[model samples]
Target: MRSYRAQGPLPGFYHYYPGVPAVVGVRVEERVNFCPAVWNTGLSADPPLFGVSISPKRFTHGLLLKARRFSASFHPFGQKDLVHWLGSHSGREVDKGQAPHFLGHTGVPILEGAYAAYELELLEVHTFGDHDLFVGRVVAVWEEEGLLDEKGRPKPGLALLYYGKGLYGRPAEETFAP
Candidate 1:
């Protein structure tokens, strides 16, 4: 067996861990919203579980506590600019709907023209340190039909990936390999 070493936490490891392809949007109550989160991940396949981590300091955290629902929208390469835009701004300062949005299956606002999306209902939340881990069950999923190939798989051209603080990159070609 080969020896491996675990490095100490870096200043921005969170940004470098393969950025998720979905824009996580949630409505807490009334008009309060949160800056979109990128720390999302797939947790299970059997029951179709997913989750995103929200720091306690974030406005989305309190929203998640009360509303318990959110929508994750996947954007194609064409919407990288919007992804960066949403990631850069905080919802506490502006009504996200004023930006550019569409009504999704769940009636929550989704970034208009997203490649695909899923509306989820929060099932449980786990608090860890400064962040809360929210696990959710997907209630509905929709995507643009033409984007898929003859085999019914998403054909990739450009997609957004994030790396620590203000850095964004496209996924490597092989990154989408089946």
Candidate 2:
């Protein structure tokens, strides 16, 4: 492969995050909204904080900022189509809850297909370049019952890993390695 210097603000740079799980961002305001996000990760364990990077231009950003509470659904295998659909559309245009999504106890929309999810109350919104990083304290966490092993560590191969340019898949595993 040939090498070239990276340029400014290129979407191609996002492709570097291969195998990052797709995440669904949910917020409720005048209308409930769900947006697919790959730019999210956990920040703390003791305080149970999670951070999601979102552009101010996104419809969900305003709702998240206004409500100061949001939920995140981590996509598992077989749910990429829904993630793609959510990422492609703006919540300002349509009701995403019309799809097969349910509300958590906090009334945040939770996709039925989530492998793991967290309901969080906003702690901070800090600016970073073009996007704002939302930090929240996880108030609740949900997971598919069989997703964990006897020791509580997640078994490999069940996560939906996103590769940029609209592609997603699980990492290859040695079938015999287990």
Assess candidate 1 and give its TM-score to the true structure. Answer: 0.80
lDDT of each: 0.70, 0.78
List model 1 lDDT by residue over 4-109, tens digit each.
4656654445725657556777765455343556777878877878888888877667777777788777777667677777767777765665657766676666
Write one digit per residue (lDDT tens) for candidate 2, span 39-124.
88889999899988899999988888888888888766777788878778888888886768777788777788776788888999
- Could you say which candidate leads in TM-score? 2
In model 2, the worst 10-residue window by lDDT is: 21-30
Worst 10 residues of 1 by lDDT: 27-36
Candidate 2 C-alpha error for residue 117, in Å: 0.4
Candidate 1 root-mean-square deviation in Å: 3.6
